[model samples]
Target: MQDRSTFHDAATPLPEVAGYRVLRRIADGGMSTVYLARQESLGRDVAIKVMRPEALGDEVSRRRFENEARTIGRLDHPHIVGIHQIGRTADDRPFFVMPHMTRGHLGQRDLAGDEARIREILRALLSALAYAHARGVIHRDVKAENVLFDDADRPLLADFGIALRRGYGSRVTSAGLALGSTAYMAPEQARGEEVDHRADLYAMGVLTWEMLTGRLPFEAQDALSMAVMHAQDPIPRLPPHLRHWQKFIDRSMAKYPLKRHHDAADMLQALERIPYGPQRSFSPRDAAAAGVARMRDLPRGAWIVLGLILAAGLGFGLRHGDDTARGFFRASQPQPAADSMAVGGAAVIDNPDDALLRAAPESEASTLVEDARRQLEQRRLVSPSDDNAYDSLVAVARIAPDHLELPQLSAQLARALATDAVRATKNGDDADARARFERIATLVQATGLADDDLARELRRDTTAALAVRIDAAARRFDREAARKAAALAGVANLDADALGRLRRQAEAIPAVGAVLPGDPARMTVVRSGDGAYALTRRHISRSEYARFAEATGRPATLCRERASVLRVIARRDWTDPGFEQNNADPVVCVSWDDAQAFAQWLGARNGHRYRLPTTVEASGSAAAVGSRAVAEWLLDCEGDCVRRKVRGSSWRRDEDSRARDGGRGYDDVGFRLVREP
Candidate 1:
């Protein structure tokens, strides 16, 4: 593909391309023109890249355009722009549709001074390339312009198939091969020799070089001269002040493909080694880690002395309260309790380095460490925002630095914190959620999860959660709530309607049928009798129970008094009887108390008051309609509320007789409503 392509004027009405209606020209490459088009069926905008009318006759360009579609169609990856549909225009031009990326390409994005974003873009590019390569497809052009971001700023590799151009010269260096962009091409690629995935790595190096220093790695007057420079020139060196990037750049762009990192995975390892931030963590070369490795060779007495020194340093350094600890200690020095974050009795040291931690890794310590980790896991799950759990885990680390479970535990805790953070944000506890995420950021090292992947998810979720809250606040016209929501979101996603959609879905109360209307002032009167108040027609159904459970954020469980581990009657829900249940059947298994709670909740939602039927009301209803199946609840018969008096025969009784019982529960047991007006 050429560095640039020309298309019809922006104001010119674009010709219809297949099923998509071209809205406007979005991009142009040497061989094709990309236009924003509306997918009528899907009701979304897509990018449709079609071969330029002039290039339709060129077989190479035709083949390349088709190949690009085939290449993208063959792979499915999060970082790669996906092909939506492929077709030919009325003018016989091949074109394919991809999800439109409005955030533009990385080359066009102003990512200056944003190291985190640059690293993220590189990671996305390399991962996409690696995936394509593993499947025998090479991304020959890996320049920043080929990388684009979605609405959430997630980078995607675009223009996959359109770059590999063949038959550039009869002076093939070795055999039939293709060349891509000249400035970013590898030596072999520039030489028009056979190339492989390694060429993509070279291109990425050039892209990275531009990202860090805002210039191409190798500058030349013309494409021909640049290709020559790439083939024979010394790999461009990053300036002395940019030395930290020298190793990554030089190795990736090495003249010899074999001299570069073997693959994307190796490159990722090198990238991970670079310090993305401050001394937030210890790396392999950190003095403490090296000293620990050396401690394995030290004598026992030396180890004891070192341990004491570490203890002393910890005591003097970690005087601040709470989970904020800046030191280490030994096991014999009395560590904090498993549940507590405050390190109280451990012997402190003046220098942590003196702890030449020499002692064969013992299973006893391992067992204790594992036990503490299990407790930590429990704490993380039940109360992830609890700083004490983090403090406790750190205490375990100080005592047993070499414990095998530390990494796994750290990762689990970080994941739990992230999950909790997202949950809190969704629940509108923005402050708590933000705090948890900040805490999670400090512990990403423990789990070995990719820092980028976790951070991206956290940020995305936080933004969405806040967006949800913003729409909700706007609906209520609460300016303070809106302001707080906006602050948490950092920047609002005005296009977001995720919250409004949920409001529509959640606000619908449970559907109840056959309501006997009463005065709107107090409550609905289902039935009026001499015994007490009013009664409802049918019994409460499973659907009502489910709605109550969901609205109250409470799980419905069978009454524990009658439920047993040995018996199969109760497994989960109050309505589910561990067998096939009729949705219309009166809800069963819930105790009188549970029933009362549901009544209270339903009444609150409906703006009324409800409670258990009085004994008089129950008997009067049975007498009024005659006995029927489905034994129902009545107010406590006697002084003891442990057993409720139930009136009417059950479904199995087959008798129209009015009878009352004070037993616990029956399979045919159910309840009906009696209301007040």
Candidate 2:
């Protein structure tokens, strides 16, 4: 096989497949070339995996290719890539279509140290494996390169070219070639031994290690050596920081299959037990160091008391001339009459511990304040360690208790967090934004900074941003965005009246493109030269017309096959126009009379007068809605009422407006309605 890296350097001719237009080659694997193509019938992008012509020459390769298509075609798991269609190209090369995973593969992503993301991918993959194993299928080629992601960044197990059914013999691998990638190959698999689902579990363990440490556990110069190492070498240990997963890795990569996890379900349970947060394991040396550090932090009062006891034990005589010793032990001893020492023209207090305590804390508080300010400048508000600004502030409060700078520092950190929260919100990361907001609230209450009004201002700004998101989503009919915005609003504690209005707007979004009588099509109010009226946002769709036809029992109209010629076809109507269309596509091939009939039927059912938009209304609405693929019928007619006016451009003609026969339907003509005020 040629190097996969050079596959794109050569300009390979695109293969012709029926009902699909191959746009470009996306990927080249050992046995197939995947192309991005548009499925014309569905009008959506799909990936077509065509067997390499050279592979088709080999009977075993041909069988494996066909087997992969048949294997995935029967499986219906969400995490598994599904086969859409299987067919042959113009040159008889076999091809199978699957969803175009636009986000690439797991190998292209960086999952290092992201336990939550890694766990998500692992759970999805394990569930897929479980499903496949129960159905007697084993994905022998489970690797990062085989795991693809969809548009939503969800991991999907793909590439089942070498998948084997439980009962099937190993004919596909009879050529003595190593099947899976050597880096992730199971020990048993590397030894050319008969393997089952447990082999995939071992491979999963290798993948887990790679994701956690950003490197493969075992490395060798060649595939042969790599395979040998998998069979004979001791299981590699995780790094010290990741030692919490040592038990999991040990069992999963056990030398024998029996010592490994019994099944995917059992592995899932083990994964659940693994903690996401870093675990701390202390050694005797570390404990001793901590003890020493604590002892060094003892106050001067404690040391003074120890010194006085020692002096009494030594039978030292007390004298007023011994000013140095007296000053040091003054707080612990009784007050000396008028002989108290005076320094720099100020009388020294008999109890020196009060001054010592205040001096020590003031020095410590100054250092803490400096550290906190530096951390704040570095944006280390709450993470990386106990050395962050938040922790420093807290330490100052504990030591000084009434440090003058504490409130100001707390307020600065709070403002910084508020900035982060707003940034997260703008980036559409509602969960991260919510977490930051909660942290800010905790800081305010902890420091008694509620009187600062920072929290209240942040709440108002965040709520306003979320409200904008809600309205924008409602306008675009994006239910997911609207739901996320609404959820964030709840977290922001938005006022009830405002929240209720936004909720109602989101609830009004249409579930489907079909506009029933009770649920009218989306419209925009247009103020034209004649009057103000509401015009439909888009041209009438086939699904909407289908509803109207079903309810009114209307017959299909004869539609012209082409716009230039009068070649009227009896079978061609809105349902069977020359091209394919989904429900959302504008309904073409409807005559002016047919459109009028539909408007009348809808108006009567909804108790509102509806008619085709006049030329003036459509011209005004076009600036707002933009031109569509089809020309739309208008209420105005030509001389003697023989032709009706059409506005906007059509698929065949890019002209703005034209007059067409009112009784005949053109394939590129549709209509939109105007609702009377």
Candidate 3:
């Protein structure tokens, strides 16, 4: 239906509405005013969301809003922002009451605080979504603004004004067809196609991308261009730090609804798998909810033992040092590996053109160039008094870490050195600029720098610059000498004959000699173990041509070991959507019993003896690296007394049994590899 509109000219003072006293306006949206209101009937404070008079007065839209109000009131969930009451005003405008959440949205908080906080927030959001989907409610609009916080700051999905049931929107027009922000809208939604809960997932994908990168995945000059990009353009790959989150976005923002997550609950569960920062059981409702379900199968003694173990682990982890305190502020600074800012005061680059130029198109080389420059600049400007200074230093440092004086100092130095060399060559004062270039190269290499292309360009530019200083008579000789020296300096300056010979020799060898599937390239040493099984070790091997003569041949082959290591044994938790794909890669969604049976079948297929599930310690450290990434389906044996069981995966937990399922099967994001040896 009709879009929401804000009341800019309404002069009436809203003293009371639907028996609730308005305190103040908490938020003003395009179509509604959210106020902190206190209910006179129950003497309780609640957030009263009121529609604009224009929207309420519209007959068709008002009926739809009333219907939505009833639908939202029936939904009961801990993760969902609860609805208290719905009523019409004296003037006949529909309004709804909800818990007065004072803390605000998760996006407004410091994300770098602790891993557990992030985890808790994600868990709560997902849990609420799961609850809503189970009841056939589609939020259709899940954005940061629609999410609010309880008194403790835990996330609660709010504002279902535009929500729809499975089939309610056909006569009313598609809910998201003409709605949602350009950057947050799903590709399907952007195209005005028939939408589903997957649209919410897509919005969440955009939100998560923003959360990790402090930037939107897609951008355009206008909404129309952005919509076009969403409809036709590919979703930008996440920055390095957010690579782990790709699977979530991939499933959430699949081109088609069928290709996206099965439902909100599935996406929420998958979110729990990602490692973020510190968490606490701050929400009493969440704590109560998770506890009741988990306690169903455990006996008194088992529960006691589990509690003791948890207490012991917590004590141990915190007794010596609190995890949050140890690295909270320190890790708040973005490390070399991460591309985003961890601190709030860091200067944000809003200019898109400069960013595009710095990054170029997506490629391994270009990514490295961008990353190296960014990292070097950040490293150089380790200390800055203000955000702008820090930001400026970073920009310059990326291009040249050595020259970190003024704004664009590196570019200035590089240009100055080049110009001086050119003048020296023109006037026959040949030494200075060449010496400077050489000094730059030495500094770069000594600092363990690795931008090979940049280094080569600098050398060539310096040589050309040198040419400008030499007299006419010696110019040709200087140019020739420069070219020859540049060629010999490990740059790609070989003749065609030599290149041809190298190519011919390389073509003779098979590209994959002793290569293993789903693994890296390296030399494999097959050795017989005492258990009468074959074990492989990675190693390097030289080609026969190189060994026989000093002639260039094929590239050396690497043999990676075929054997898999066991990660850990985890109990089956619940199903998660691996995203939608009309392909056979869809993982089998099974329960704990199903997983154990599958493990038995797998072992039987490999050999007669049953392969036992591993312990937490056994699956941890270097040992777990040999196991699987997806651990649920491959887990062996069930622990009868407790939820604790063995599976193939990494566990940040100590004695606590982690859960795994096949919901993430289609994901190459992370999984386990099995090997007998």
Q: Provide TM-scores for the models.
A: 0.41, 0.45, 0.39
lDDT at residue 429 of model 3 (Cα atoms): 49
The residue-by-residue lDDT of candidate 2 on 68-122, one tens digit each, is 9988876766698887668899999999888888787777778887888998899
Once model 2 is optimally superposed onto the true structure by TM-score, how far is the C-alpha of residue 360 displaced, in angstroms?
56
Top candidate on lDDT is 2
lDDT of 3 by residue, 609-667 (tens): 22223443224322222222333223433445334343433222233244433222212
State each model's C-alpha RMSD to the native. Answer: 24.3, 17.0, 35.0
Off by over 4 Å in 2: 1-11, 282-677
Each candidate: what lDDT?
A: 0.64, 0.77, 0.49
Candidate 3 lDDT (Cα, whole model)? 0.49
Q: Residue 437 in candidate 3 has what lDDT? A: 52
Query: Comparing 1 and 2 by TM-score, which wins?
Result: 2
User: Per model, how many backbone clashes are there?
Assistant: 13, 0, 51
For candidate 3, what is the TM-score? 0.39
